[model samples]
Target: MPIPRIHEIMEADQRILNAFSPEKLHRLGQAIGLNDSTTVLDLACGKAEMLATWARDYGISGLGVDFSEVFVADARDRVRELGVADRITIEYGDARNFSPRQRFDVACCIGATWIGNGVEGTIELLRQSVTTQGLMLIGEPFWRKAPTAEESVEMGFSADEFSSSLHELVARFTACDLDVVEMFISSEDDWDRYVAPKWLTMRRWLEDNPHDPMFDEVRAELTNSQLSYTRYQRDMLGWGIFGLLER
Candidate 1:
């Protein structure tokens, strides 16, 4: 089997888990109109960074769900650290079928749409907890350009997996019967920030656990992955977080 995700090995949640900086994440949240009265439901919300940040900066109230107990625990502490514990709840659970107690003004699945299979299915899931006039937010990686067969499968994706371009991604929203309200696309620098840390973290783990059986596996995977991401994905991927309202 493939090695576990990098976060599984790290102790604390790093900042900006996805290919976006905290500033861009904040802008994306604000562009979607978050405010004190807004209630958000974030699925697969690793470390609850987005919601917790919103709660701190915009006074938004929210609930975040993730499968990682470690991440959830850290998230709860993060909320308390930011003094938004009362405004946000972080739960340890599967995000795929997480049922919220009430509808929310915003429903988000950032960089984890796989929880609902894909973008289309994730929107359907998010809609389940969205108020009538609420917004749905999804962060997905689209193709900046076509990749070779080898490049495509390196990310466990086929050529058909990603939208052809940024324009196609926008069209996908309307096809799903949602209107695009706003968007935040990541730059090449953002991609580096998100991926470079994984390399450092993994290397450190290998050094610290030289005798561990999985050491070589993790090391090889890390080496291959870093090379693949740098050679293909960094150039081919364009990740964007979109804000949508029902049409």
Candidate 2:
């Protein structure tokens, strides 16, 4: 099975596949100063919602790269639906191997830094595709409160998967010689919006695909996810998008 298949199932009905609302995304677009002249490169851009919306609202043009065929198809459809097909290109490929012909005004890898391994590595990856005067946007999770090793395991991640705190996350940017210029921290409501919808989707999928080979896997995942979210992630974890400028 494709690595993204599980994610595709979990986020089947989602457009923006992260802990962000449309209003917050729009606010972030505005905060980033997007314009008709700004060109963006979005790596691991799920469904290209940000690109399509920014194109329609801010008149920006962009290219989005993703690993999921399903997401790429949806992204293309989204641009057309938004009447911004002329302003955006969605490519289905490994984002890490995407070497753009020209550097972009903004390089973003929201909620998918794993494409470059981690925060520091992802910064180095984005730096290659952004102009010196441009900005890079990264969305990452941090620990709201330090997690016990057992809690981290229950939350479905290794103990060190996230930074110790939001402050530590920002410090990682500084260590990479970049400055955090602006940020959007996810509220509990945002987390609820991102995670809670998966249960309904998974439950429906279970009802519809009773005999599929992955049925049991999905069922187990859904149960574990619910438990993890309630007992650990909701209070112990935080997510945010940070805008970074070169120092």
Candidate 3:
């Protein structure tokens, strides 16, 4: 089966596809204590918002890799818009095949660990790209509470899919041989920002492309996504971008 590219529906205009508020995103950057000497390796970087923002705000340099042609193009344009083109490189390719071209001060798999199949594998991928003292940032979702057996099977997610709690999530990191240094957890408001705009984007696209072949598919995706989010994700899911180090 083909994978659904969620970001494709989420809209190209969006710089950050993750449930991160501008405040929270800035805080994530702050956790790194970004400086001019910093460099980053962002795998599965959707539109490279964090890297672009860091470049503009901290004068850091980095390479962002993602398989989405549209997203990679947008990321390039974003850095150009921020006048940091020289400091940022956006590559369009399969993140699973992406090897570290150079060592980085920070290597991130954020929000797209599925590229490496799961968190532990993704951490290993990031680990290969990071310098000795480099930070590894992984963005993952934890269950705020365990879903009942009934709720588990909804929206193609089983209760078993999530870490039982935050404690287990941290344990997963330790099992991967990484130290949990710091983290920036997303608030409901941040998730709201990430999701609400996509609704508007989908609605607008549907309005403009009523006769298009994808109308039905897009409509169904919009409906199902909205339903799944409101019914299960918002209340049951918690997300965090954790900073890690080799143990």
Candidate that scores best on lDDT: 2
TM-scores of all candidate predictions against the true structure: 0.93, 0.98, 0.95
Which run of 10 residues does model 2 get worst, by summed lDDT? 1-10
Q: Itemize residue pairs with steric clashes in candidate 3.
A: none
What TM-score does model 3 achieve against the real structure? 0.95
CA shift of 224, model 3, Å: 2.2
The most accurate candidate by TM-score is 2
- Alpha-carbon local distance difference test for all models: 0.85, 0.92, 0.86
lDDT of 2 at 34: 94
lDDT of model 1, residue 14: 76
**What ranking of all candidate models by lDDT puts the best one first?**
2, 3, 1
Distance from true position, residue 197, model 1, in Å? 1.5
lDDT tens readout by residue for model 1, 1-247: 2214545764233755689899997887777777899999999898888988999999999999988877777788889999999989988888887887899999999998888788889999999999999999999989998787877777666877878899998898899999998888999999888888877788888888999877877888788878888788899889999999998
Kindly indicate the candidate among 1 and 2 with the higher TM-score: 2
If both were scored by TM-score, which would come out higher, candidate 2 or candidate 3? Answer: 2
TM-score: which is higher, 1 or 3?
Answer: 3
Candidate 2 on 164-226: residue-level lDDT in tens?
A: 999999999999988899999999999999999999999999999999988989999999999
